[model samples]
Target: MRISIIDTSSLGDRSYLIDDGGVAVVVDPQRDIDRVLALAAERDATITHVLETHIHNDYVTGGLELSRLVDAEYVVPAGDDVAYDRLPARDGYVIEAGPMRFEVLHTPGHTHHHVSYVLRHDTQTAVFTGGSMLHGTTGRTDLIGADDTETLTHAQFHSVRRLAGELPDDTEVYPTHGFGSFCSATPASGDTSTIGEQRHTNPALTSDEEAYVENLLAALSAYPAYYAHMGVINAAGPAPVDLTMPATVDPDELRRRIDTGEWVVDLRSRTAFAAGHLAGTLGFELSGSFVTYLGWLYQWGAPLTLIADDPKQIVEARRELVRIGVDEVRGAATGAIDDMSAGSALRTYRVTDFTQLSSGIPSDATVLDVRQDSEYAESHVPGAVNIPLHELLARAEEVPAGEVWVHCGSGYRASIAASILDARNRTVVLIDDAFTNAVELGLAA
Candidate 1:
């Protein structure tokens, strides 16, 4: 069997396309479906099965669209009623597709209907241990309809224990999620593990059964509030979305939207957006995982437009928007900021924070402390003006420019403050490290 593991790291996700003799089965796919389809076509393989271990909450699933693209059988665990087309899968139900033989095991704990598949090839064995049985820790049980943590924990323990007894020691284990994934907080950092290694070192199996239950529950990080709604989105299926890049909008058209109250998402590198962008556009640094962070920042269904640097970055921005169900990418502004000047006035500046401001004295600039009333009340630069970071979008006119110093408690909020002010066409100096060394200089003086 040939297996290709696709990782959605920024979203805490991983998936695979396992091929048994030129026929493929894709497991736990993300919204970006083209990559999976392209891989199958390149290898001359036909995708006969699309399997989802359980309904996930982190990113939208593309299983339905993938099945549509490949004309494959969409299989999910039984007991949950899902929309779109699907073949119900249950425990001990063996299915065959090409050379792949699947032994489905009902493994609940992560959810009431979670299942793991044991795949046997001609020469070797492998298990698709979904969210239920990960490398280190079990999937968190607090999501979906899981109300009884203790009950779910008990079910999880039994599920892991069941795997130990049924799957042989030599069976290599492939799970859908890894450590960084919110699916399981303490997922093993590495990609793959064998049943033998998990038997010996998987945290849940190694700990005492009772302790395992308690520790697993205690170790969980903060779960996202959107999880409940996402569960529905996953099981039901995502609404049709455009993965192809949207047509480019004139930069002048983009400015019009901002004027009418639409949000202009600047998906440029922080450095690029910091240098120059149209006024009132929100800057989000796009590098590792845009979809993941976008989901966190906005409501799942919020409408947004791309203010990318140019044509190429627009594709990246649109893909990210689809991943978290924020699919309305009216389109990107071609020549972005440059397009603005011919039609309307534009601006630029360097972003900085309190730490940067404290390090040096321009000796002839005004310091703008963009922190809140509460933050300012605790401590603020004595001579610095107070305008909290959140309010900078509207209060930019108050801060004096011409080598203006912008700062926050540390440098994070300060950079944002600087960016907002810079977007307003001011020459601002960053004082990110100002307070850290302010007293030392005074003493020296």
Candidate 2:
């Protein structure tokens, strides 16, 4: 048996294409199905089955669409009241494709109906624990609701133990979440792990049930606000992803959109965006974290537009947005920053590093730290106000008036916060440097 990992690192989730020379099975694919199709073609294998561990709460699942396209059986957890037709997967259900055999294990933790697939061949063994048993941690339990978090965490503890006790110690472990994904209960440790390795490393296995439950609950932080919409979309079956570029908008239309309070996002480097950008445009640099934060803070169903240094950036941004169900990117404008400004002078903010911050901040200048609550609690610049980047949009009024200087762990969130502050007509300076620099410079308290 051979397993090919399909990593959507931006979302920190991985899909798998496992085959035994002739037939393949895809597990937990993202909304974009082309990548899965390309992998299957490359392997010279036919897709016989597409299995989903659960109705995901992070991104739209491509299982239904991929199954339909490839004329394969779509398998989903048995109890979910989904809109589409699927092969109901129950505990102990066995699926065979060529020489590969998959035994369904109902591992409820990430969701009430989550399942893991144990793959077996002549001698090789592996388990795809979608969100149950991660490398070092488990999937977050609060995604369902505050009311159900404890119940799920308890179930999560048992689920991990069951996998550990039942499966061989040498079984290769492949989890769907935990690689920098908000879905993890805590930061995931390491990359590749085995059942034996995880036995010693995973909190679920190492800690007692009560202690594990308590610690998992305490460690949970804020996840994306957009997650509320993902499960509903996935359960109903997501539509085919449209990667085609949105229509280009001229500078006049772009200005009109911005003036009307529509979301006009600028996808460029944080430094470039801090230097000069359209007055009303937001700076969400086109990087791995771009889609996650943008989806979190975006006003759902709003007419969204994009501004970029190149059209290619906008194209990639659209692909990322579609994964989280940000489908209608109304229009886009790309080119020189000055040209996109439409006759009016572009707005600019001061970008400084921690060295400048270490020198001295003015007595009255408000220092805003836009990292998460947990991050700010660890350590921060003295006298800096803490409003997490996700909360900044709603709590902008809470930030004190006059000459606000903002910083985050990295400058990405700071640039985003700075742009929002700039849009509100506040005097803002962006600290575009790593937080480690502040500690090195004796600025962190």
Which of the numbered candidates is closest to the native, going by highest lDDT? Answer: 2
lDDT of 1 at 197: 82
Per-residue error at 120 for model 1, in Å?
1.3
RMSD (CA, Å), candidate 2 to true, equals 0.8
Give the runs in model 2 whose Cα sits over 4 Å from its true position.
none
- How far residue 408's Cα lies from its native spot in candidate 1, in Å, is 12
Stretch of 10 with least lDDT, candidate 1? 436-445
RMSD per prediction, one decimal?
6.3, 0.8
For model 1, the superposed segments whose C-alpha errors exceed 4 Å read 145-150, 224-228, 341-445
RMSD of 1: 6.3
Tens-digit lDDT string for candidate 2 (51-156): 9998899999989989999999999999888999999999999998888899999999899999999998888889999989998999999999989899999999
